[model samples]
Target chain A: MSVDPPVVHGHINGQVFSAAADATLLQVIRAAGLQVPTLCHLDGLTPVGACRLCLVAIEGHPKLEPACVTTVAEGMVVHTHTPELETYRRMAVELFFAEGNHVCAFCVANGSCELQDVAVEVGMDHSRFPYQYPQRHVDASHTQFSLDHHRCILCTRCVRVCDEIEGAHVWDVGYRGSACSIIAGLDQPWGEVAACTSCGKCVDVCPTGALFRKEDGTAEKHPHPERAAQLAEARHEHRWTNP
Target chain B: MATKPEPPAPHGLGDSLVERLHAVQQQHGYLPPEELQRLARAMARPLSEVMGVASFYHLFRLVPPGLHRCVVCRGTACFVRGSERLEASLRQRGVAFETASCVGACGQAPVLVLDGAVRSGDPGELPWL
Candidate 1:
């Protein structure tokens, strides 16, 4: 018999609740039906806390912490929504929009983009920061997938998923700060990468239209966010024994 | 005959990814993609992680520099003290120089480091200026 994980008591937005000790604050808040926005977080993948959208104010703490990575503990108080958090979240979303050439009208993930949905939910009508409009290139070298740097948010989700889950480290980031970009296999063009397995896992986890299948048309895309979780569950259950 | 102490081993996979890249840059003057790939294999790390670290730090150079690398400090103190003037003078001389966010020497305002030598003071005072 497997023992259950210990329960940790915590106050989220002033509501007391007990959650599995191993669960992150985001998971607890989500279980309690409180919506906390996230961009770089996906189930079944290690959290890098790259996106600052899920920052929550913990009582008695001077600095805000990301909900997705912070583990829950006893007597902890977390505020998921506040005016300050809303302002910061709005700016984070705006910066994402300003940093990249995210033209939603022409993007392949237009109606289904998590970034667009978050922007609308956060009430980002316009960007306060000036648009960078940096020149970026697109790579359609992969036989099945294409990468568009113009829409990438530098979240490292695809990078992490490809490395941790897919076991293929073909993708890497090149450059620093505002000029940083995702490169495949030593900054080579994607078509020439020999390590790529063409699994399409990166495309499924991409929050934006940055990675997409070659056959997908404009706004004709649907990413499977649960695929990774399902795969993890099957692996843990040893479902392959049926064969 | 006196024997010199053996030099430290070239930074390899056993060291932090950053140190390995630094060692590579120190040897090659800049990071080459082929060498990075070899380092990735030696270190058993993903190329993406290696590349990420390589690109994140300003100190790492991926491309070869010109014959001389002139770094001008652009910190607040230097900017206030007329670092721009020194940069302008260098530009007029038809010499290439790069602007650094800061040289960590605010007291020495308007500082310029040419070929790894630091110089400070009014733009016109320096012999080259």
Candidate 2:
């Protein structure tokens, strides 16, 4: 006897929808044609819930839950775009801008940056929180790519893509709190890390100007964020077509 | 063409990874790069993952320690008893010292470890002062 996967009925923004029992709230919300601002939630990659921008208010839950990691349940009432959620999402985007040196004018991913897009989506004109302006450095040691720590949001997209897809565990988060940054092979320079295959998957998946090609100047870099999902899907389906 | 010989495997340091790292740190006063690489290989984990865990904690020193080691406890109990003043004094004296969140000695508030010896007293009673 063939058994079908269980489907759960849920209400998103007061609209009823039926979704797979194991589907995440973000997936269900996206299927319902509702958009949720997310930075750390990338398709095909593991949902880490690092970014709180995708937080949605659920009935009976006191606190806003990250839609990327939250699973849909039967008879669940989810609100994706509430007034409080809008305020919070805008605040999160502003905090991201204030915490790091995201100078869009001189950035490589200025025209094609996810962080900038998210900021516009949330309508974050200015940040109320004081700008941190932490001292960060740029690592251009690699032959092809460069890493600007100032623009990095620590979304771990580069870390996950390199490890999960490329099968190269070259990148890892080092230090703690304010000192946290991505390190390559025991804090060595990117060029010095022998494990890196130089496949450029990390650079492709970077949401901001933090990782880009060395040859690219201001606003010249074009990141293909969908490459992760495409490559993951292709690998899973055993189809090696060009993305 | 001559094939390269495999490097000698590190001795089995037991199951606990952190304990093995602590043992290495204790022996070298810090975790050396070569030692960390060996430990990673022995544990069958990637070097980056091992380094990630080792570098996350403040206690794990990657660089060489100074000649005179001093650690001040900055826990709530210690902070309430003027550990900040003791730290300030140490800083003023140009003495390089590390800080621990808690040393599990709250009874002796404002505790300090001078070269691995735990002592709890007022800032004025410090030997450096």
Highest DockQ scorer: 1
Best by TM-score: 2
Scored by lDDT, the top model is 2
Alpha-carbon lDDT of model 2: 0.88
Q: Poorest 10 consecutive residues of model 1 chain A by lDDT?
A: A234-243
Can you tell me the DockQ of model 1?
0.30
- The candidate 1 chain B region of ten consecutive residues with least summed lDDT is B1-10
Share of native C-alpha contacts between chains A and B (below 8 angstroms) recovered by candidate 1: 0.58
lDDT tens digits, residue span B46-88, model 2: 6787888899987799999999888899999999999999888
Clashing pairs in 2: none
Q: TM-score of each candidate?
A: 0.86, 0.91
| Per-candidate local distance difference test | 0.84, 0.88
